[model samples]
Target: MMQQLFTNAKVFTGTGEDDFVSAFRIRDGVFDWVGDAADIDGQDAVDLGGRTVLPGLIDSHTHPALMAGTAAAAECFPPAVTSVDELVDVMRAHAATVTAEDAWILGRGFDDTKFPERRMPTAADLDRVSTDRPVLVWRCDAHSAVCNSKALEVAGITAATPDPVGARFERHSDGSPNGVLTEIAAVGDVAAFIPAPSRDEQIDALIALGDELASRGIVAVCDLLSSRLADPLTTFRAAAERGLRLRVALYPGWDPEQPLADLDDDDREGRIRIAGVKVVLDGAYSNRTAWVHEPYPDSCDHGLRLVADEDVRAAADWARRNGVQLAVHAMGDQALDRVVELFADEEPWLTGIPSVRIEHATIVSDEYVRRLRDARMSFGIATHTVFFFAEYDGYEKALRAEQVPDAYPIARLYAGVEALALSSDRPATAWSGADDVMLSVEAAVRRRTYNGIDFGPAAAITAAQALMLYTGRARMLSPLENVGEITAGFDASFAVLERDVFTVPAEEISEVRVAETWIRGERVFAR
Candidate 1:
């Protein structure tokens, strides 16, 4: 690689110091130096013409392949399926294009609450689409999956097929399955036919999604991979070996394709460290499956548990012993408690390691927040602050009337000892770049949604603090120390900005583009 120098640009290292520098040079992909142009005059130079520059924004969490994996087809009714009639119309349209050999007709993004009286679709709805072919649609949560009569039969799910622990098989009072599957294990029958793509294709699709992040100024991602998504590390490892412009830290999931439980996080050759093992404790809040401590005001139960206590402890221990950390996805208070209790256990090897990540710290409690700090738990919050936008996309009244908050609790965690850090949980939720940065810290401080609800204002933190969570404290969510900051000795990873966030209006932060982004002194993203 050739040396490169950038000159005449204003810079913000995201450190407390808002130092504007004159030049930067990179040799062999590391920051050789940064300062007066005269210091490196003999080195090759490219003037930036006084543009803004900052370290590349690092995405603490996301699922790259699965975000772009849904096969594109007809109009997806999604949050629009207001009635059985509407779903029927959309299904019929999707079925019209393919032959029986194409096998299943898939429907994604249906929000059950959007329907009149908030009812979910059943196997009967599939009759309107196609009787000979299988049809399966996913709820917006991606936790519960709905199948038609054909799909149900293919799974051999007669009334006799028993539902397993941690999985829900919604059935009729008459004892027949209603064609809904919840938790990853419940959907196994359908996933068998998902048709595996070659590793290269997986890499291409994942890389394509990364480009979307790059356009938004995200230069690196904590790529969360699952059994359904398979061994993305191999593909990403290959890309890094070839010197791709992006950086990724791979985390494994529990699924068929990802039998990584036996493997270690050692990755000197992959160019990507094994971020950790990802575990799920419950389902999405949208589907009402999150294992909450209190019942949703109108509901009778605490919802679901994606994994049992024993399983979580086992996984966390494995992560603790190995070099990798544990990144648990626990939204409900009960789930969070289980994680904290297990994490706080006095295990010799577990001490001194960074707090294991609790992805989507949605719907937390005051007790949970304190416990998290006492136990030293860390989190990668889905701070797109999107929940308040569009009135949480029209589910507000139904959700608020119940008054039991869903999604992770930013305020409590922020007010508690832990505070907050940022993560996009992408494709899992519709993602936004600036909104993520703003929401992580701003939402924590404001606690009011864009829609004007003081959801939990008491938990909000100041703007300056939020920036630290995303930039300075965020790297700790990984292996710790050398990531997400802009100190001189810390790798020159920073984002150049039109305005220093401390001085910019919080409302306008989301709209500001990165003037330039650098990693290890190399220009990874420049606008």
Candidate 2:
């Protein structure tokens, strides 16, 4: 491969200030050399016009395939529909466009807390849209869904049906299914009835998602669950074969029935790899089912636990024995505590595995932080502060006055954990613009919600520190090698920005545009 030099750029090496490089040489898709312009010999050089350059951003935890699937779904989120009537109107319009063959009307990104009615839409509300066809609109969090009567009937859920082990179908006082499904089990039961997307459709969606991520300067992501594809590995392979742009480290969604075996096959190469198995130990905090230590304020119910402790232990043991990483989705304090204890106890058995990760450690107490730090376990934390920016109102309603201050304490986690990473839980939090790394970074730095509320201001960090979480620290947690830094041995992937993120006001970080995104010494996106 010919050597290409990038010069006249302000480069943040992602190390400390002393490692800053003004020029770098790329050969064979890896950084060949990096140094000040005076020391570097220019050859086949491309002047960057003095633009700012950083390592291509990585979303340590996101669902690209899943978010792409919603491309065709109707938007029922705020600013689109602030009232129940408006929501029904949007769905009604979407329902009218559906053909007889595609009978179900699907929608996503609805938040009842922002609704003027201050309640979840019921089957009766949706029946007004269509009584003949099934209608399913998922909450912004994706942890819950409100289905129409036809959808409930199609899913075979009725008052006579017992609630799933760890999920619930919210009902009226008369004991009839009220069309609100909470948690994955309940939502999955109803969602299972929806026709699965074709393989071609899945590939198309993934390709589009790749382009979208590339446009946003994202060169790689650790996709937590590729979603309910017929075969996630095959689907990703098909996308990669078609020249999907972004690098992906996939962790197939956890299934209790499946054995913990390594699925990293021949196709596991530079762009795609089965990194680990992702399991959700508890539901999200937005839905008030995050398995917290204390009950949610104004309610006697302490959140729900989706997976049993024994099952988590079994999965952890299996992953350890098989030499694969295990990533658990534990959001609540109680859930996080249980995971810490489990890892601490299993420390003796762990050997060759890279790292055991805890996703969305949202509510961490000082004690929990100390326990994780003191255990001396090989662990990683993948968290998102964007939730605080998008869902502060909902969090305020769900948590107590004291609990609100500790929510999404990114700085605290950064101080306590060694392998702390940041991510954008896109589509989960429906802000004006979702899945943007800058938005997440800004939220972490500003510690302010969209409504201008100061949410745990003390937990805020500097822009550079926030950027490190996405670049340097994030790489330590994932299976991706030779990436996430502008060093000589790292992959030749980086993003040129319109403005210096380090000099911009924290609130203006999201406004900083990406002038170009390059991967493997090749330009993938430019604007």
Highest TM-score scorer: 2
| True-structure RMSD for candidate 1 | 4.5
- The lDDT of each candidate is 0.60, 0.81
CA deviation > 4 Å runs, candidate 2:
17-19, 41-44, 68-71, 258-270, 348-354
Candidate 2 lDDT, 1-527, residue by residue in tens: 66788898899887753346799989988898998877665466788888899898888888776765555678776557777899899998998788858558998888787777888899999999999889999888888889999999999998889899899999999888999999888988998888776778888988988888887788889888764565666788789899786778877776777754554455345577777777789988877889888889889888989998788877776666655678899988888888887776456333432358999888887777788767756777899888878877678877787876677788788888867888887666656456778888889888888789899899999888888887887877787776679988788999999999888987799899888998888888999
Ten-residue stretch with the least lDDT total in model 1:
430-439
